[model samples]
Target: MEEGKPISNIDDELRQILAEFMVEVIKLEELVEVGRKFLVRFQQALEFLRRPSIYESSDLVKSIAKANETKRVNAYVQAGCLNAYDSTLSVGQLNTSLSDLHDCVTKSKSIIDELKNLMDKAGNALCMTSDDQLETEIQASEAIGSEKLDGVGCASYMAVIYSMVKQDYVMQEKIVSSLSFKSSSGELESYCLMWSLRPFINDDIIRQALKQVR
Candidate 1:
């Protein structure tokens, strides 16, 4: 960003980074498409395997239910730990009031409790098979795609941020500082980007998509 730097050089470098970021975005889209297809096939497999007679007689249903429950708990615990890390950063660097992480975790647990209550009611009202649960999960996923992933504004902004960060050390520091200032309460909002994106990242699919691009 220095005045003396040649504008053409800067433009060329920026264009390169922009192209790379767009390629990444395209790979992500392809990964999402493959993941959707995988999910559909997985659901079909579950449906074929979870016929009423088979599901009632076999332990597979219970095993899957338990596995899903464990997965959800592990996800929540990981999220809480990440939140704690963010709070640590805030307290250590920003000299902010130490966040009450216990309270935050408790609030998260309360939300889970409410969801469990809803699930219980649904379970009582209807017979739930693993296939049915798979369908419900797919529906919930579609809802999330509609609610959060529907917007490209955040993605484009992120691409800009990525390009900025790929610049020289001074520029990166300035960019981070400016972002922190623009963020709420001087907190580093950028720290949450990768964590927020964890749910959407499919490493295997991404790898395959990248291979295609290469």
Candidate 2:
């Protein structure tokens, strides 16, 4: 009976640890969803900023600028408009969109920070050897293996995805911050292309991650 009791206690402790690990996995999934939402918001703002015609002719942009007179005055002066009302109007719309994009990027930074902390906790919980090293080793093929990932493998996979996403977000923030009325068409085109390409983020890995969650 004594031996049986010890075995039972060990089993219970193992179960408890597994439960905690599962809880962290669920939390990670939830945070990933939230990060997805923020990414969409930031993408929308970037798309709007990319297309001058869309914002320039947008009644919504006009309404937003009209609601904020200070922004209108600042845009007109900073854009270096002389007497062309149409040019001033376009510049005002651009400024408003840039401001919105900046806000989205700022919000995304907070989400990324939260995700980084969560990934660290998850890695520690899984007793991973080294989060930094694992991040580089774990690839889409490994993440999408036929067998289910062990605790350490799962945590490492998530860390890799998080690192890529964080890098992509940093790149996006830099691009958005660099945009201005003085930016040439070529620069704007390059910015749009880079955003669309998303060089840092691997689509296959993200798809595999989603599959794991499902």
Candidate 3:
């Protein structure tokens, strides 16, 4: 970041990139809201379709179990993305981010594992459904929502996973890897992370966050 230079400096590029990233963050917030709703409703749907008299003999329960896993994996990926992105900025310049990305990932995994439990519960209830209800809820919902032609919960979870993890976390990893640094080891992974977050985070300040966390 030299003074009176016609070319763009790192600070300038960082501001530009951050502005772009915020647009996606806006989308993430909305998707998270939608995800929160779907989790609740999907659970309710399973509870209703689980009545012993209704689900006594059916394969519909199986689908619910699968959907639960689908959703859990999606949320888990999102959590990973958040951890990765935050880590990029959290670590110090010329130093690895203060918080260990793997540690944060481990903590996040615990929360996401709950989705697995919900799925198991739904599966047990589905087995009891009679043929008619199975036809209605499991096979019949094909025409229920706007996605009449596509696979159901799978796509929803897929989209969520792509948004939270790949779009931000995995993608950012590539950018960090691409960045070139001066006179430093991979410790400069910290500098690369800070580059993406330059707009709101002063270099010195981010340096401290990385140090504090470390």
Measured by lDDT, the strongest candidate is 2
Question: What are the C-alpha RMSDs, in order, of all predicted structures?
Answer: 25.6, 10.3, 30.2
Q: Residue 7: error of model 2 in Å?
A: 15
Give the range where candidate 3 is weakest over 10 consecutive residues by summed lDDT. 149-158
Model 1 agreement with the true structure over 79-158: per-residue lDDT tens digits: 43234454444334332211222232334334334433433333332334332342333333334432332112222222
**Model 2 accuracy (lDDT, Cα):** 0.58
lDDT of 1 at 62: 49
Q: Which parts of model 1 have CA positions greater than 4 angstroms off?
A: 1-3, 54-214
**Please, what are the lDDT tens digits per residue for candidate 3 over residues 95-141?**
33212332333333333343333332322323322323322333333
Tens digits of lDDT, candidate 2, 105-197: 776677677666666666555445577765665663384486545444556566776777778778878877787656666666676677667
Badly placed stretches (over 4 Å) of model 3 are 1-8, 53-164, 167-214
lDDT, residue 126, candidate 3: 30
lDDT of each: 0.35, 0.58, 0.33
Question: How many steric clashes does model 1 contain?
Answer: 0
- TM-score for all predictions? 0.27, 0.59, 0.24
